[model samples]
Target: MPVYKVYLDQVFLGNLVMNYAILWAAAKLSRVPVHTARLVAGAALGAAYALAVFIPGAGFLQSVWFKTVISAGIVAVAFSPVTVRMFLTCLGCFFLASFTLGGLAIGIIFYLNSGRLSSWDGIGKVIEGNFWPGILLGLIALWAAGRGFAALLKKGKFENLFRIPILINSGGKQVRVEALLDTGNQLKDPMTQSPVVVVEYNSLKSLLPEQVQAGLERDGEADIWNILGSLSESSLSSRFSAVPFQSLGRANGMMLGFRPDEVVIERQGKLARPGRVVVGIYRNKLDPEGSYHALLGPNVLELTG
Candidate 1:
């Protein structure tokens, strides 16, 4: 029975670094937006838990149930997931990332110790050996793998990713169209603060007022603004709004958007009506091959039916 020296500072700092890295990797793998403050808080909580295990009366923290609870808490604090499925996804990714890094660390330790794992002395020798290089290599490999997956979804399998049917109801007219969910299309109406769905002008032209359609068809920005201004006195004034958005080549771009009476989106055999959605009219074609008529935003999917 040998006693080992445990430095509180070393344990806390080591856990803090590992926890933050694991959290960031999970967020990237999950494709969820990361908030720096939230990640820091989550990492600090995890690091504090690691320190608690060393306390004289805190042995309960080492139980399986406690580990599960703390892991869930860390993910919830960091990601702020809106649904059970999202929370589970984040948790799974977190575990995957943790296991990957842990495996890499273990492999490195064994490699440095000439593939011997029979004694605790071999583990202690890891401190004498250079450790960061191997860990940094593992991190880079994980990052590259995540990036490669994203590129596959964006470029390799463009058409199969979350393409769904959408039905727009307005002005006693209904327009059925195909939409490709674009997570990057986070455009929202500045005035009403409603999510904006970018739709091709030709696809949704039937639902727009004749004057509005004609106004949107015009080439000049000034004329488009003038027509929209005059619509203030019209009966359908409240339905129309100006949506500001930024894209790859265009900066400070404005699009004409109108509120639909109802919008129904079909996802995996179920119909969902995202609340307060505004349809932003895009004059150009969304897809060259006519695959999708609209670019759907991921934010709208968060709303309940």
Candidate 2:
């Protein structure tokens, strides 16, 4: 009998690699909702499962069926409300990756040992220097492959993959909100031709002047152009404008617009200013679920560039 010593540190590192691989693969395969914190937690669970092989009474976990169950738990931890089809696909890909890596490691180990299969007997009998090196090399190769796959996906569908965070500055105040990239929002400030970003009135009410806020809160019964005349003589009044738009059941109506002091998109930990965007107050919520309050115009991205 050979004493198989499993180092706890190695087990943790191994689990991290496996977890990242599965997540990277899934991101490449489809447009699935995922977050970094969940993936890290899932990786910790996987490392615990891998370390189970070293426990005296947990030997059964090494069995194929038991390992499959553990892997399922890992997948569930990493993604929320995964469909049956997606779960199966992820599991199959994990297995394929495992087998591929195992084969590659074994082939390299055998080649390094003078191509003599018999010299590298069962693992219990001999401890060769090349054994760990081969495994390390295999791990590195898998990480590189996973990263390459993710890079391609980011290049293709990067914008759709991430939620956009925006800050609207107006009237000496600033409000932050999430926004959806909306190409259909071609409404603009009629006077300056600047692009418009539509937002729910309630979400941005605090930033509006008290007088302006009270006037627009009447369920929009009064015409916006008429309400504009009542604004006080302030910089905020100068910022206000009327935008004409045609929507369902309404042929011609005006939405209240304001030239923001600055409209910025936070990307990659940096604030990118999209020059001179008008914020239009939409009486209705853009997202009933409240995932995002604003519908950002495609022109925002174009102007930022």
Predicted model with the maximum TM-score: 1
Winner by lDDT: 1
User: Can you write out model 1's per-residue Cα lDDT over 1-305, one digit (the tens) per residue?
Assistant: 77678889977887888888889888877766778899989999999999999989888999999999999999999988445666787899999998998777657656766655566786666634546566666666666776777687656375676798899998788998999877556777898888888998898888887788778776765355766887887889888878887772487888888899988998888889888999988888887778888988777887743
lDDT per residue as tens, model 2, 61-141: 899898888878877787656555556656666567767667766666766665344543643222255656777777677
The lDDT per prediction is 0.81, 0.71
lDDT, model 1: 0.81
lDDT of 1 at 264: 91
Which 10 residues in a row give candidate 2 its minimum summed lDDT?
A: 118-127
Q: What is the C-alpha RMSD of each candidate to the true structure, in Å?
A: 5.3, 15.3
The C-alpha TM-scores of every prediction are: 0.65, 0.46
The CA lDDT at 259 in model 2 is 76
